[model samples]
Target: MNVAPVTPPRPLDVAAVFPQLVPLARTATRLHPRPGAPTWYDSSIGGPLLWPADEPWPHCEGPHEVDGMNPVLSPADVRLERRIRAASHGREMTPQEQKTLERIRPPRKLPMRPAVQPYDGSMAMLPVAQLYARDVPDLRAPKGTDLLQVLWCPFDHPIMPRTALFWRSAATVTDILGTPPEPPAMQFDAYLPEPCLLHPEQITEYPDHLELSTELQEQLSQWSVPQADEEDMDPQTYYDCVLSNAPGWKVGGWAAWDSTDPCPRPCPECGTGMEVLLTIATFEEGDDEGRSWSPYENPAAEPSPGSDHFDPGRPTAVQIGRGHRQHLYICPAAPEHPHLELMT
Candidate 1:
C-alpha cells in the first residue's frame, strides 16, 4: 500500500516576520477616552461618556459586543494606568516604571481625518491612512529590498467613528497580486452604522468601478501582471474612489458649507468631485442621524438638547453656498474647532 507523505508546514519566517511584530507593540491610543468630554471622536452613539475607574462604562447588548476589553484595563493597558495613578499620588515613577509607561501610553499624533478642504471642495471625517516606511531584513527578500508597508487604520484616529474601523486590504497585497482582472469594492449597502465584531475571514470584496477619477483611471491603466515596486504604491486612492460613491455620510458631527457660488464641491480627500456630505440645509438631517449637529443650523438651536441657550461660542459650520470649489480646508490647526475653509 502506497502512503502519501505529509509535508511539514512551512517554518514561521522569524526574520521576515519580526518586522511586522514591532507594529503590534506600538501603543494604541484610545481615540475616544472614557474620561473626556464630547468631540468628533465621540461621533458614534451617545457621544463620549466619562469612564471613571470608580464606575463601570455603559455596555452595548447585541449579537456582537461593542464594549471593549472587560474591567478597567487589559494587561497591556495597566502600565499606562499605573503611571497616571502614581503621578496623582504625588510620587515620581522609577526609571523602569517610566519605560514601561512610555511603551503603553499612546503616542502623540497630529490631529487629522476631520481635515476639510474648501478649495478641494471636500470634507473628510478623518485622514483615511497615514503611511510610514520601515526597514526589514528578509532571508528571501533580495539584498536590495528594504522598505516595508505600515498602513494605519482610519478608525484608529480619534476623530473617526468606531464603525469606520473596518478591514482594508494592504496596498502591497494588490502589488503582489496585480490588479485583479475584476477588482472589487465593498458594497455601500452592506455597511452598518453601528459597530460590530468582524472576523478576518468574513471580509467582503468590492468592485472597482463605482466612482472613478481620471488620475485613478490612469493608475489602474498602468497596472500590469507581475509588476515590481508594488510595495510603494498608494492603495488608499482605491478606498477614496469607493467612498466617493458611499450612499450617505456614515458618521455625523460637523458639516462644511463653502462660500462658493452654486454648490459645495466634493472634498479632494473624500469625494471624487466636489462632495458635500451635508449642507446647512441638511445639518438638521445629520443631527437627526446622530447626536451632533452644526451650530450654524439654527444659530438659535441649543448646543445640547434641552439647554436654554445655544453655545454661540462654539465654532460655526461651513456654509455650502453656490460655488465650484472653496479653497478652504477643515482646520487641522484647530481639531476641537473644525469648520470649512482652505487647506492653509
Candidate 2:
C-alpha cells in the first residue's frame, strides 16, 4: 500500500497564547491502519508474525460462558444475508419472501461450549496483530527486539479479551510457523480484526483537560481575560484545539482519563512505573475535539455507513465496551518484562 504523509490541521499556538504551557508539548505517532491483508513483514492487525516453529503458541485455558442462542454464521451465510438486505432495500418483506429467505438462511446456532476447550492438549491461540519497528517507528521495544506480536483467545475473559504480548528479534526466527490453529467460534465480529497496514504519522500532543491541575484548568477556561484579535473566538474552542490531547490509535501520548482518574500502574515483576506503550482505541475521536488528530489529507471527507472508511474511529474494528479504549503498558526499566492491559 502507498502510505501518504498525514497533513495535520493547523492548530492555534497555545504556547503563544499562554507561555506557562510551553513545556507541556509532546510528540506522538498515530498508526493509521487501513483495511488490507498484510504479510509477515508488514505491520498489521490480524496479520502473520515472524514466529519460530519450535516455540509453543500461546493459548488461554478458560471456563468461558457460552451463548447457545447466538451462533457463529459461516462467511457464506453472512454474505447471503448482506445480499438479501441489499436487495430488500428497506421495503417491507412479503410472507412468501420471508419464508423463502428463512428456509435458505436459518438462524445461526453457536456452540454451547467455549471456542477453545482447556485440556484439549494443544496450543490453540489465534493471532491478533503483528508490528515491526521498521514499519511502526513509534514501537518502543528492547534494544535487541524489533518485532511485537499480540494474540488472544476468541472467548472473553471477564470484562475483556485475555491478551498476551511477545517481543522478539525478527532475525532470530529462522524456522517460522507457516500455519496456526483458530478457534471454532468468535464471540463477536469486532473481536475479529480485519488486516490493516499502518501509516504512522508523527504529530504534537498535549495533556487531556482531566490531567491538568484544577488551578491550571481554571486559568485556561478564563478565555475572556485574554486579549485577542478574533472577538468571536470561543475560549472552549481554543482549549479543545490547542490544549486537549489528540485522539485515535497513537503511541507515546497522554492517557485519555475522561471516565476515571489516573491510576498508577506498576510492573508486577518490578515495582518500577509502567509507561503507556500503545493505545488500542475504538474510534479515532471520541468527540469533536478529537478531530484535531484526524489525518491531514482529506480531513473533511465523511465516510458513508458500511463503507471501508466508515467508523473512522474504529479502523481496526476492535471494540472494548461500546467504543472505549484499551491501554497497553510496559515496564520502562525492563522492556522484556510482562506487560499490562487496562480498558477504559
Candidate 3:
C-alpha cells in the first residue's frame, strides 16, 4: 500500500486580482448611491449621443451583417416615413394605406424554438427562451422613433449571444419598417448596451438607458485615437481591427470567400486557378506605401516595427500592394464564376 503524496498549496496574489474585482465589488459594497448619485440623462433626440469631447465614439469593428434589402429600413427612412405621412394632409388612411402600415408593425411575441431530439431524437424537458422586438413612435415625431421592445430567452448560447439578440431586435425593426431582412453581422468589439436589472420601484424610467460595460468603455477608449492608425503602430495592436471589421467569419464581401479549395476553372487574368501565394501584409505611412503621397488626405506615412507580417511562405519581408493583393492573389481562374464568391 502506498501513502498519498501531499500537494503544495498554490500561491494567490490579491493585488494582481484587485483591478478585476473592483467594479463588481464596488457595486456590491454600496446598497445604492445616495438619492443623487450621478444622474445621466439622455436627451439626444433620435440622433447618436454627442459623445464626450475628450473621448471618441466607438465604431463597429467586428463581423456584422450588412442588409441588402432595397427600400432598406434605415435611420434615414424614419424621416421619409414622416414626410409621406405629413404630405397626406390629415386625410384618413385608406384600406391600402392601413394595410401598408400594419405590415410594418413590429413583432410582439417571442419566436418558437425548434424541437430537439435526445439520444432517441426527442427534446429534453428543459425550458427554452424566445426573443422578440418592436417599434414605437417618437415623442417629438421626426427627430426619431423608439426602436421598441426586445425579449431574450434564458436558453440562448453564451458564445456570441449578443449577435443573435441584436439580430432578432434589429429584425423586428426591419420588418415593421417594411425593410427586407439582412443576414446578421458579427464583429469583435461591437456590442449592445447591457440591460439594467432593477425592480419597477427602483427604476423610475419606463425605458432604461443602455449602459456600456466598463470593459467595453475601455476598449472604445483605446480604439478612438486617430494615432492608432499609424503604420508604426504594432500590427498586433490592430489585431482588434481584423477581429472587429473583417467580413470572413459571417458571410458576404471579398473577405468571405475561401481561396484554399481547388478551383473548377482557371483564373480570370491568367486562365488558371489562381494559386494562394504568400505575401507581406504591409502598412504604408499616410496610406501611400506605393502611390506618390497625396497632399489632400494623408492618413498615415511610415511603416512601424510594431506591425506583424503573416506569410504562408517563409518570407520575412515582402512588398505590399504590388502584385501581391489583386493581380497575383485575388483573381479567379474561371471566367464563368465570380472570383470573390463567399464561402459559407
Q: Please tell me which predicted candidate would have the highest lDDT against the true structure.
A: 2
In the range 219-279, model 1's lDDT, one tens digit per residue, is 5445421121332323433222221111111111122212312344344454433211111
Candidate 1 residue runs with Cα over 4 Å from true position: 1-36, 39-47, 50-96, 99-249, 252-344
Measured over all alpha carbons after superposition, the RMSD of each candidate to the real structure, in angstroms, is 25.2, 5.6, 27.2
lDDT of 2 by residue, 157-206 (tens): 66667788899999999998898666655655566665566777776666
- Evaluated at residue 272, the lDDT of candidate 2 is 93
Order the candidates by lDDT, highest first. Answer: 2, 1, 3
Flag regions of model 3 displaced more than 4 Å.
Answer: 1-102, 110-234, 237-271, 275-334, 337-340
- Provide the overall lDDT of each model, using Cα atoms, as 2-decimal numbers: 0.23, 0.66, 0.22
> Model 2: residues >4 Å from true position, as ranges?
1-7, 18-24, 67-69, 72-123, 224-242, 298-311
Count of backbone collisions in candidate 3:
33
TM-score of 3: 0.18
192-282: candidate 3 lDDT, tens digit per residue: 1111111000100000001225574455446434334553443332322221112101011121121232234355556664322111122
TM-score of each: 0.17, 0.77, 0.18
Candidate 1 vs candidate 2: the TM-score winner is 2
